[model samples]
Target: MDNLVSVSLRERGGRFHAVFYDPDRGQKWRTLRTSDRREANKRIRIAEDLVSRGDFDPWESPIPDRYATLRGAADLYLAEREKGQLSRNTIRSDRSALGGLCSHMGPAAKVRAVTSDRVKLYFRELIDDECADSTLRTYHTRFKHFFEWCRRERLVRRNPLDGVPRPAVSDALPRFLSHAEFDALVGAVYSDAEAKARGVVDGERSKHTSLHDGDIVWLAEVFFVAVETGLRRGELCAMEWSWVDMASRSIWVPANRRTYSDKDSFGPKSRRSRRVPFGAGSGTEAVLQRLHDETGGKSGPVFVGQRGGPLDGDYVSKRFKEYAGQAGLSEDYVFHTLRHTCASWLVMAGRHLVEVKEILGHASIDTTVRWYAHLDPTRLNAAADATFGRNGDRLRQARCGGR
Candidate 1:
């Protein structure tokens, strides 16, 4: 490997000639020629300084011998992440957050040139204006990650967020489905007409070939899978004929499938990759198997759009609402309601708090407890009893301890 900053010269016709060298294993570096060795040396010095300062990647060309654009700096940051075997889903998530910054901050803004005050103000306004906590956290996480990238690349002299504090949020349980509810959701809830309409499927869902009969049975199955499996919309969409292993009875979560969110208009949710364990005989996998048997199983997305792409989640939400209305379920319920329902069911089943935490991918148990604490009064009561010696004893103990 050749050092990008090393000075090297090739003489043309015995006259002095020089150019900056960038090593490529499978390709040759192209040089921009300079006439004078002294000028060439100056150019080399600037190039080396710029590269050292993280103005550009060591291998990238067209690097300005000056400040790098936020876009350019981002490229360098992302390139390293890509090389590190980071999942595509994770990369996309980070990319969305970081790209949103460049888009909002302006393309010309240099990561190195960005000041502390500007960043502070940016977050301040986001919080003060009452942007959703989740949304603000996304920005903060992305910004901190970008700054960390700068630190790694040596683009910034110091971390911009060193003094900044991330907003604290109480860990709340995510909603999922209950067993009974999931059973009801996947059973014969959808009608022949509604399923025939291919409710949630975007124009992309129609690729399964024309259906002559009711697929409500299949739709019901799909709803169960969503709630039971906790698979995101994109994961559901990207599933293909081969990913399903009926004998093993688990649907393989493909790392390459597109995310179902409209945040980027269309595509995978992130580059983060993981295979989910889908069970056999009941819940989601059963519905998937039924669909597989009907469609030839050799075609495109499992949940094809009306246009033959994966079903858009937004459409799913609307369709779920319609189904709920028809079934007289509450209106406040959304597609996400299934997720909540699942969590509720887990708590109801007396699953360990840690087990629920892992199942939901929650970073903390406090999150799980927050949502399911109502269901586990005994656990809290037990803890309270340990600390204060039962309800009445706690009152007496408090009076004595205070005295």
Candidate 2:
């Protein structure tokens, strides 16, 4: 009662207050609403008993309220998230995950009623529906964030997600295109363009018009830049001509930049800027020069859609899939495969993982190693030979006088 609960009088209001110390929530105060010393003492004793029983939260109500429902708290949580700097996509994902959770667990279910066992059952249902482990992990992450917010807001006594286990996603290697596959993919782009041009000339009914020669060239350059620079689709679409330094052969990917218009705003996924370099002979400079000349305007987006605005990242992925399909590549190949291809090729060419990590703008070297290290078995073999092969044995024998 001494440290866990204390009673104090408000000199100005002439009312008694009950002070309680919660290990998890820290110090909390509750107004006893009585000025009489005897009544305040009785309330203080009750508070002490509640503290001893580990039910000392003053915010918890004896009766169910609107905010006590899962649906109501989730709405408030999402509303608060919308006011922050989080991207719209993040908030949308949060809403999607929460919507599924609310639907599965009855919208009016009490927030406190969501036990760990219930959450485990929900995840089991998701698994039964054949949700991929990666997708399940994303849902789990969103749920964790949502419930943590609820806990901080005192909507629930504790985060139910804390008791639930995270979904286990496999550490599968990233998918990448082989050299022949890469060539075929690029060739497929030109082939499709030519086919469309032929359709236009033959006056055949086609759903889409043929891309202009300049646009075709831009598309090819986009592919080249993606595979070579390992830029994310968002980074590629958001890139500006000014970011390309032809003199230094580097692309300056900014951490975050805001303009007067939201359309022109962009930032790296990691929220850290980096300099991505390209070889002089890698055709990147030539491609940038061609794009610059074709656009006739040097300050706006490096990649633009038919309307000349910033290219949509989602569209880029969809378009890449089309080209991949045309090239007879596996449907699993995605736009991000270009990034994996870049890292894979670099590692195969004897580049250090640290170098690949920097070039790819990865947050950690571990990520670079995890995805590309297995592709460099030659390097590992070479290292092993250098340390324990015939030459190493000879040197050791020479040092030990043939022992």
Measured by lDDT, the strongest candidate is 2
lDDT of 1: 0.62
Clashes of 2: 0
Put down candidate 1 lDDT per residue, 1-403, tens digits, no spaces: 2354454555564333334544543332323233346644665666566666767544555435432677877875776676554446568878887776677678888777666677777777776777766777777787788887677545677888776777677455454444554444444254444454663243344555455335444456557777676565555655666767666766665444343434312233333444445655566666677777889778677877667676666667677777766664656567877766766766676767777665555556776777776876677766777887767876988999999
| Native-to-model Cα distance after best TM-score fit, residue 83 in candidate 1, in Å | 5.6
Candidate 2 lDDT by residue in tens digits, 344-392: 8898889989999988888888778778899889888889888878887
**Window of ten residues with lowest summed lDDT in model 2:** 257-266
TM-score, per-candidate, Cα-based? 0.58, 0.77
For every candidate structure, what is the RMSD over all alpha carbons to the true structure, in angstroms?
10.5, 9.4
- Clash number for candidate 1: 38
Off by over 4 Å in 1: 1-67, 75-92, 103-107, 171-220, 240-286, 295-337, 354-374, 379-403
List residue ranges in candidate 2 displaced over 4 A.
1-66, 200-217, 257-266, 385-403
Q: RMSD to the native, candidate 1? A: 10.5
